[model samples]
Target: MLHTNARPSDRHRPRGARGFGLAESLVALSLLALLLASGLRGGTALRDRWATAGARDALVALVHEARSRAVERGGAVVVLDASTHVARLESGGDSVRQLRLASEFGVQLDLGARDEVRLVFDAAGVGRMASRSLHLTRGASSARLVVSTYGRVR
Candidate 1:
């Protein structure tokens, strides 16, 4: 039985929720697009940051490798910054090189001095009679790879 004041049409109202109107649908679509755009932009930025950091870490690791190789081979291993994106290791100033690597991440290397030839790590894992400064850079960020006067790497 229906209430005395209830309209007959109201009795026939369908159960459950109603569907969205055109205006509501449009507003929802707009909100979704905005969210998607923000997410994609953030993702791209994070990827670039990761790539840059990865490149920096890899270069540091290469320095360690060069030193270790020099000690293992009982000779001077020269680490050269062939370019902003390339590096190589030459043993005993010979044309024959042991290892070479190119940047796979979003970073670059800039030598502090043009006159600087190459990093020579002796058989004891110590830099040659000199210290060198290798600059690790990315776009606007930079880190100094300093070799101490005592042939210590820092």
Candidate 2:
């Protein structure tokens, strides 16, 4: 009374048994897409922040450079901005250098109520403008870069 043939379950299993169900596949795909989208958005935000910060630091450096140059060369140095975003330094009608910041950085210098901004530093490293506030803005946030008289550059 021994049975020679095996039962149907023992003979074979479905080849696609290891594969995920349709619902499971759909959910996994959706999660992956969401993750990818968020990562891309975060990267974009980070890039914008980095560009804005770099531009701000460059502006600060330009101010310090102009002051230092005036003291070192024993002459008057000028930090002027012909446009809102572009800034340069000059000494005795000669352009000392052009800053690396351009309009693409999203940095705007708002003079507030002033007609123009022409910061001049004397040979003794003293600011001639007395007291002034230069606005540095990126997107919705802004900060003031103030310079006081007595050759002080802040």
Candidate 3:
């Protein structure tokens, strides 16, 4: 058997530096909690932005579809009604599509001077109305879909 000069109490002692004190541990925990909270807030803002973008894209696509359909079918394609939260498309008195916006997105439509805007596209892909701007808004952010008299969307 090997002989050792160390005392019995020395065996129970830590080999090197001691672990963190109570105050140090508390400070670390508080920092971690603050970091987590900020991350959560960022995530929520990102989600809201995504939803707003999605809603705007969908609206633009609907307009394009109606325009194309009017040219192909050789008749009028109409966006029958558009309000703060909904838009309806119709071709030849038949429902083409309907889009309902979510409340969380807070989307609003601003078709100037019109309670409900009827967007009419003729067979030649020309709009009956003059050049106008259709505004889509979510909170402070907004997107504009401009409709020219020549039936161009930008």
| Candidate that scores best on lDDT | 3
What does candidate 2's lDDT look like per residue over 1-154, in tens digits?
Answer: 8765755765575655556889999999999999999998777767666766776677678778888888887755545453546677887778887664446576666777764677888888787776777766666556566677654545
Model 1, residue 142: displacement in angstroms? 2.9
Model 3: residue 143 alpha-carbon error in angstroms: 1.7
**Better TM-score candidate (2, 3):** 3
Return the lDDT, model 3, position 17. 50
Tens-digit lDDT string for candidate 3 (1-154): 9887877877787787568999999999999999999998787667656776777788778778888888887655545234546777788778878877646456677777776767788887677877767777665566777777766778
Residue pairs whose backbone atoms clash in candidate 1: none
Best by TM-score: 3
Badly placed stretches (over 4 Å) of model 1 are 1-25, 36-48, 82-84, 92-103
Question: Among all windows of ten consecutive residues in candidate 3, which has the lowest summed lDDT?
Answer: 75-84
lDDT of each: 0.63, 0.70, 0.73
Model 2, residue 143: distance off in Å is: 2.7
Error of 2 at 105 (Å): 1.8
* lDDT minimum window of 10 residues, candidate 2: 75-84
